[model samples]
Target: MSLHFDHNRPIYIQLMEHFYRKICRNELKAGDKLPSVRETAVEAGVNPNTVSRTYMEMEREAVVVSKRGQGTFVTEDQSVIQQLKETTAEQQMDVFLTTMKQIGFSEKEILDLIQKRLSALENGGDSNA
Candidate 1:
């Protein structure tokens, strides 16, 4: 698992997002055991305490199940995974909309830009117009 850290946000939140992406992409399957906290911290170059906190938060959210004397595994709930995907998408959309508004983009202009980008992406990144 590879994680990229941005300086502006909390490392734990970024770690959570990284895990979400991995789960969504099937890189980490349900019931797959995650790396040890120390291992992940070393790999990600972050404090071990931060990695532990991220794991703890994931446990609290039912995203992972911990086995005593074993390790932490991804939860085996497809519904929860789907919900995570939807929640991530919604959060991204909210950020996009808020940023557009802050940049003085009118709703119509934002919608038009969305249409243009969607069309281009749907057409394999070739201009559709």
Candidate 2:
């Protein structure tokens, strides 16, 4: 997965979230080996220590498991994965609403924007066409 870090938060936290989302989305499945810390760090342009820390945190959360000589793999629990996805979606939606409110967008305006964006996306984003 390609990870982009911003100034708002630490890179390790973003890495953890990114990996969780990937697993929750089934992009990474049970027994699927993850990239090495060095590889991921190089790919994400971050320090290996950050990636290692993120993976360690994920392991502690039971989102991933590591084998002694093998690599880290995504967990196999369907319920846990589903719950994570649901929670992530809800959290993202809440954040979106909060940001909209902060930007002076009313509920109706936000709903309209969502509809428009969905429609545009469904129409291949060719609004003028």
Candidate 3:
């Protein structure tokens, strides 16, 4: 739970994204119980209010559900998880494309770079090599 916070973004949003990445990677499975707010605050080195806000936002997005006297749990719906994965992927791809284009990369160049990286990974070599 060693999260490095980027001060440029809101802490709660970063916390939410951290949890989203965990869920997307299957590290936090469906119906997994999230840590208590106080626990998360301690772990993330943020205020309790930030963790609470993060949990609230996640609930609003239907990414997790809070059970009274229990705790917050990741959504059990597979469709919701699948949609989350797709949405996260699109958001990440959009960011990558925008950054590459900003650096003067054309669409074909980006596509070729991606293909080369994938081929390198498939061949068990470092993509950066």
TM-score of each: 0.84, 0.77, 0.92
- Of candidates 2 and 1, the better by TM-score: 1
Candidate 1: give the clashing pairs.
none
Model 3: per-residue lDDT, tens digit, 1-129?
658999999999999999999999999999999999999999889999999999999999999999999999999998999999999999999999999999999999999999988998999898554
Ten contiguous residues with the weakest lDDT in model 2: 120-129
Show model 1 residue runs off by greater than 4 Å: 1-4, 126-129
Superposition TM-score, candidate 1 onto the true structure: 0.84
Candidate 1, residues 35-103, lDDT tens digits: the string is 999998988888999999999999998888889989889999988888887888899899999999999
Model 3 TM-score on a 0 to 1 scale: 0.92
The residue pairs that clash in candidate 3, if any, are none
Q: TM-score rank, highest first? A: 3, 1, 2
The lowest-lDDT stretch of 10 consecutive residues in candidate 1 is 120-129
